[model samples]
Target chain A: MGPAVKLKDLYFKYSIHTDRSFILQNINIELNRGEYVVIAGRNGSGKSTLLKIIDLIYPPERGDIYIFGNLINEKNIYEARKRIGLVFQNPDTQLITGTVVDELAFGLENAGLSPNKIKSIIEETVEITGIKSLIDRRTDELSGGEKQLVALASVLAMKPDILLLDEPFSMINVIYKERILKIIENFVRGGKTVVLVSHNLETALNEALNNSLMADRCIIMQSGRVEFDGTPASLFERKAEYIESLGLRAPIAVRISSEINKNIDRNFPICSDIKSLVKQLTGLKGKELKK
Target chain B: MKELIKIKDLSYSYNSQNDSRSIYFRNKEKSSVLNNSFALKGINMHIDRGEIVGIIGPSGAGKSTLLQHLNGLIMPQQGSIYIDGKSVIDEWDQKELKKFVGLLFQNPEDQIFEKFVGDEIAFAPLNFGFSIDDVRKSFKDFLEYFGYEYSFKDRLTYKLSGGEKRIVAFMSIIIYDPRVLVLDEPTASLDSENREKLIKLLEDWVSSDRAVVLVSHDMDEILRLCNRVYILNGGRVVSEGPTENLLFDEALLEDNGLDVPEIVRLYLMLKTSGFEKIKKFKTETDFINWIRELKNHA
Candidate 1:
């Protein structure tokens, strides 16, 4: 019922000097549990910094962050981190061991779980992630997408309540990207909170629609501040202004929809997925259905 | 068009024993799978001059490896490479290869080591025996062409943002004016504005005397810029054709670990759903025009 993660007046700067000094100022957001929230922003807009702060990697200069209704402090930071799984853009950064099986076992081992328990968890994770074939492969041999999956599996092996993925789909192939999205869908259906920072909003939009699980909120960040936050559709409607003002590209669907809406007096539905967009076009008032 | 980079039956394998440094240092191999953990099996593609050739495949599909071979970063163990009709293996030396092929690595941090942007861009040109005056003039021209301020040359390389660093890294390679350019995900970190600028720069710079080989996961960029696309799956060429027809085939794309662009997807979906009239649209603008026509008829 409460927010899974809450940020209040978060302000961060690497240093005090003013010239090109990095700053994340006056940030306030409340992400409810079991909700999928996408954080879209241009590079260096503090998207990754925000995720790092949530993971307790960076201590905010001035702010209060609550995780699972518990205020995060130095005392509770480690405990809070245990409840969250953070995957970065490059999976290799987080991977520790040589083999996939060993990599998955490392986290559980760190948590001091029994060897038998770790084995069972690894088995279940491989099944859930559908990476059974990769169990014996070397971490260095895995492709970028496979590497991301292994990273996800290693993180999920800990059974964290919250998932924070920063551009997990950036280097992944399309098919593997779909598989990763399906895994994320399953995670959401299981009532876990997810905050994904990605540039590929179109893929995310399609995945959300296909699963019948639209993003509860979309937050666009500009200059380390929250520019817009609302449903995906609302975000699409104002995409032009965001593109111009925030320096973020609107999804292809949003771009086309906006172009049509601007030139036509009649309202055309903003369809995020290709199927729906086609339906809207072919099912127009003046169009004749073949069937 | 002249064939700039040609490969036939190319296969490369990274064996544990083949790692010379590790073998010399440790006196033994590290991993047990000594044969070939990562291998490109029988890859063949010809990159023509003045055109952008795209390589797309699933992760670990050896796309990056394929790009490396074009520039001789990775020597082919099984096949041959021809650069402008000359055998890459026999005719090319380290300096000749370095002078003839410019590779913009996947990660800027790996390639850009100089403290200042000016020195970073000037390194390759100077290394190849370019006079100091020529190098300076070329670097300045490159910065101006990319819309980067002359002052950017003085900025710290690491201080620049990810996109800026990538651009600088790319410019560093281009200053040498290699006959062939290979880019690994050039637009991965760029914002929309910079991406458009870089696309325009590529269009202006790539000509019949020069060619480009681009390896990227972004299908849209591949569709927009590349004249021809080669889809590699498991280190083998699964498909190759003109960009439009290759990207238009939804099933082929999906099978090769790729996806059609959203507009193309919409067209295919409508065509399959009994909207035969959708055949007229190939791009989003075409579809928009069709929508305008429908609005007028209404």
Candidate 2:
């Protein structure tokens, strides 16, 4: 019921530049605790920069950020980061250990949890991510999807209240992508906050919309500015314009469904999984047709 | 439609076990770490002179392993590979074939090593025995196409962004003017804008009569570029056919752990909604146009 994180007039540019080539500028938003929030933007729109700032990895040049009602300062940066778990875009950058089991357990150790407690948490997270089968396997030996699951398990094992993941599903195949999505959903349901930076627009946005149903929040960024901040339905109002700012188009499902709904009183809903969207729309068909 | 690259009943595995060197020295008959596993299992594939084929499957499907076989990176254990009417295994001459087939692996860090940006771009042409003058000219042209200012030539490679690193990797591959291009996970880490550029690049390559084989998990990208799709599952080419057939083939796609495109599903949904004629439109533009026409008819 409280704000998990807050960003006020945040501006972050490359450290080398005093110029205006920032990834984000004049950013303002609030993320609630126990929310699964997805921040969508085109590449170079500064979504990752924004996440790094929130996770306390990158301090903003100017602006204010508060974590759990506490203003973040230089002294408490490490403590803030420990409360927020960030699974980097490249698993290689994030996975420092040599093996999956160790990788999954490292974050807990870093969080300074007791060793026995870390073990129990790692066991639970590994089981939830279904990486128990892959725990002993070499991180390099595991497939892309398996490595991605290990990455998620590592972060989840830390049990941070606010989890920040950048392109978490990029390396994964669709099967493992679905599995991680479920685990993330359960974490949010259990009152953890999540902010995900993703290149795959459809899945992250749809999942945030479906279970949360715009109940959390969606922040669409353009040129380092908060272009739109509202529920999914509100963002859908200026779908074309919002997509252009996001450096993408309205998703195929939204496009097709809206197109079909143009001729009828359509719900024009958006969903990530095309198969499930098909089944839902097919259910609305009057009767079985004679093929 | 001549055969460009061919693999016949090939198999391979990694000598990954720690005891392989020590144990093998002590006992020469010790089995390798990849003893039981096969990276590639009797793969038999044929690419025409200019065909864009999409290889799709879940993780650990041997997609990356198969791409490595085109060049001499990893020789096949039990099978033979032929490129441009010559058997690569028996003939043992990929000097020109290496130039013909340019491979871009997943990690940019794995393939890129030069310090300066221009040197990194020129690394390939230099390897192919191009004269300094000739390599310099080719590097200049690719840098121009890649939209790098002249100032970027001396910049450090690691300082470049992820998208920039990938562009340099592509430029390295393209400077040689390879006849066939193989890319693994080209669009995965890129943003939408860069992803669009790479898509356009592939679509153009497909039109240029240069065969391009892609092993990617992005179904939307596969639908857009590839006319033919090869679905690999469990170290085998499980399904290969036209892109239209592959996209509509839900059972095969699902079996291989792939997601069907959203447009196709919406198209099918409109079937019993009294619009059953044009339910197979592939792209966003095509589907939107279908709905535009469906409005008039309805």
lDDT of 2 by residue, B1-298 (tens): 4777777887766535433232102343433333435656777788886788888888877888788888877777777888877877767566776887899887677788999888888878888888989887877775665555777788678766565677778888978878889888887767666677778877776644578988777787888888788888878888889999988877778888887665555666566555566557778777556545544444
Task: Sort candidate 2 into its docking category.
Answer: acceptable
Off by over 4 Å in 1: A16-20, A239-241, A264-269, A283-291, B16-38, B116-118, B131-164, B280-282, B293-298
Error of 2 at B8 (Å): 1.3
Residue-by-residue lDDT tens digits, candidate 2, A147-225: 6677777877777889888877675776776776777777788888888876546656654443343335667777678
Predictions' DockQ, in order: 0.38, 0.31
Judge the docking of candidate 1 as incorrect, acceptable, medium or high. Answer: acceptable
Error of 1 at B280 (Å): 6.0
RMSD of each: 4.3, 5.2
